[model samples]
Every structure is written in C-alpha cells, then in structure tokens.
Target: MQPNQHLRILTISSMLMLVLSIYMVFVYAPLEIVMGAVQRVFYYHVASGWIGALAFLITLICSILYLATRNLKWDHVALSSVEIGVVFTSMNIVSGSVWARPIWNTWWTWDPRLTTATIMWLLYAAYLMLRQSLENPQRRRTFAAVYGIVAFVSVPLTFAAIRIWRTIHPVIIGSSDPSAEGNFEMTPPMRNAFFFSLFTFTFLYVTLLWHRIRLEQLTVQVAAMQSRLLNKLST
Candidate 1:
C-alpha cells in the first residue's frame, strides 16, 4: 500500500475502535448501584491511566535508544511519548476527580494514588520545560532522555505508595463484607466493555504517538532547512 493509504487505514481503524469503545461504555455497561452514572467514568479513567503509564514506559525505552545511538528519531519518539502521556494522564486525573466527587465526597483528595498521579504529571511538566530551555537540539534531546529515565523510575514507587495508603480508608461495595467498598463485581458484559475500552485506548495511543512523532520530524526538517537557507544567504 502507498504510505498515505496505509496512514488512512490506520486512522480509520483507530477511530472505529474508539467509537465502539464509547458505545460499550455508555450503552452496554451497567450503572453501578452505588455510584450510578459516576462509576461509568471508570472506563475512561482506568484506560487513560493505563495508556499514560504505558507511554511513560515507552519514553524510558526510547530514551535508552537515544542514549545508545544518539539518533534524533529516538529523541522524537521520547518527546512525543512524554507529551502524549501527559495529555492522557491529565484526562485520567480529571476523570478521576469527576468520579471521586460523588463517590469520595470531594473533587480532590490527598489519597496516595491521586497524589502520586499529580506528582507524575508535574514531573513530566518539568521535563518538557527543561527541554524547552535548551537552545541546542542535541543537548535538549540528551537532557530529556536522562530525565525520562529518572521520571520513569518513580512511577512504580508512586503507585506502591498510593496502594498502601488506600488500604486504610477502603470502603465496602457490592458485597455484604465491610472491607470491599471500591471493588465492584463486574457482570460479563461489563467486563467485556471494560476490557474492550482498554484495548481501544491502547490502539488510540499508538495512532496518536505515530502522528506526533511524524509532526516532530517535520518540525525538525523545517528547522534544518531554514538554518541552511540562512547560512547560504549569509555566505
């Protein structure tokens, strides 16, 4: 297939899967008895959370490649991954807030998971800003790679801290037992919807990452061309 044809096919498939996932979430998935419509937010919430983590992991991997090869393509991948990860993670945090408002009785809380997510968001924010401060593209890429590795190491630790904290304030739900508040037993359909959403979002992430990396490559090419033209004119 031609490159444009292949790109079009991937775009169409990504969009179709996204639409199906949305349909499953709103139409087929049953409303939680306790949280009602609010619990439905968990579909996007968890999916975004998963994708965000995956993006950071990819960023770390791309960082390794950049350091090993000093290739600008790896830098583009690393930068795009972090940027896209930030976008999805931001959505995850906001959707978590929407769900938490009714269920947790607040829009924001100091809970471990919530707090760690916020920190992860800020760390990437700083990473991006650090990249912006450098004038040299090579230096920016190397610096960002180092930061990516450091930032990724903290993701698991943040999760572990939050999980441990949630153990104390856990609420009981969907069970006669008092210790199971957040645990909603899923019907088969709901399970299907949840997993389907996850699969769809993973594909969506892949599509977006590809597009973003392409954009970065184009931007770099334009920059190099402009520099060459200026040098020619100066000579």
Candidate 2:
C-alpha cells in the first residue's frame, strides 16, 4: 500500500478509537465512590501526560540523531515532536488542574510534580521561541537540536518528582506517599478504560506528528523556492 493509504487508515483508526475511548471513560468505567464524576477525567489526564513525556523522548532521540549525522531531516523531526509535545503537555497540566480543584481544595499548588511539570513546559516553550527568533536557518536548527537535547532533562525530572520528593500528587500506577491526595483504587473497568485511553492518545500522537512533519517539509520547500525566485530576479 502507498504512504497516503497508510495515513488514511491511521486517521480513521484514530478517530474510531478516540470515540470508543471516550465511551469507555464515561460509560464503561465505574465511577469512583469518593471523587464522583470528576474521577472520569483521570482517563484522559494520565494519557495526555504520557503523550507529553513520550513526545519529548522522541525529540531527544531525534535531536541526538541530528547531531550525530548532521541531517536536517532529524532536526525537522525533533522540532515537530517538540511542537506536539508542548501542546499535549499543556493539556496534561490543564487537565490536572481541573482534577485537582476539588480534591486539593485549590486549582494550583507548588507540589514537586506540579512544579517540575510547569518548568518542563516552560523550557520547551522557550525552545520553540528560540528557533523562531534566529535569523539563520542552519544556526537555528543546530542550536535547537542542542537545546532540545538538554531540555529533555526536564522530562525525566518531572516524571520522577512525585516519586523522589514529598509531594501531594498521587502516583496512579504505583505507591503513593502518605500525604498524597486524591488517591483511589482502580477497578477492572477503570483499568481497561485508562489503558485504552493511553493507546488512543498514542495513536493520535502518531497521526498528528505525521501531519506536522509533512507541513514542516512543505514549508522548507516553499522557502527554497522563494529564495531561488529572488535570486533570479536579482540577476
């Protein structure tokens, strides 16, 4: 099959799975006796956070490859991944705040997990800004690759914050600290729904990353064309 055919299949599959995941979250999964309806957000909340970390991991790998081979394509992939990573990280943070409002008695806190996550978001946001502010394309790409590599330090730090520090954030799949707030046991149905959401979000990420990389490629081609046209006019 052709490449477009693959993308088409993925797009359709992602859409269907997303709808099914929503159903599983709301209807299939049993509600938490404690948190009530608000517990439903946990399905997508952890899923988006997984994607945020996954995207940055991909960026880290691509950035390393770009540095090793000096290939522009790796730089493109790194940049595209960062763009997607930032958006999903935003979703993760917002959703977490939404879930926290009632449980934590406030919308935000200075908990270790939350603090590291916010810092990670800001670091990548700065990466995007740095790329756009540079005048030279090659310099921007090279510098961004280096920055992407270094910024990934925040990803692991954010992930480990709850585990390593005294924080109020609950670790969903693992043991939570005694002070952790909003902790609850996952029913079998909740596990199925939560895992399915993770799979669906991953599928959605692949689809979005493909489209974003294609757009970046097209932008580069258009810039090349414009440069050639300007040269011809000068002659």
Whole-model Cα lDDT of every candidate shown, in order:
0.82, 0.93
Q: Which ten residues in a row have the lowest lDDT in candidate 1?
A: 168-177
N/CA/C clash count, model 1 = 5
Q: lDDT (0-100) at residue 142 of candidate 2?
A: 87
For residue 66, model 1's alpha carbon misses the true position, in angstroms, by 0.7
Off by over 4 Å in 2: 1-3
* Alpha-carbon RMSD, candidate 2: 1.6
lDDT of 2 by residue, 27-63 (tens): 9999899989999988888999999999999999999
| lDDT of each residue in 1-235, candidate 1, tens digit only | 1156666778899999989998999999988886688778888888898888999999999999999999888989999999999999999999878877776677887766677889999999898999999998778888999999999966786556534554322322222324324556778888899899999999988889988888897888888899999999999
Report residue 8 deviation for candidate 1 (angstroms). 1.5
The best candidate by lDDT is: 2
lDDT of 1: 0.82
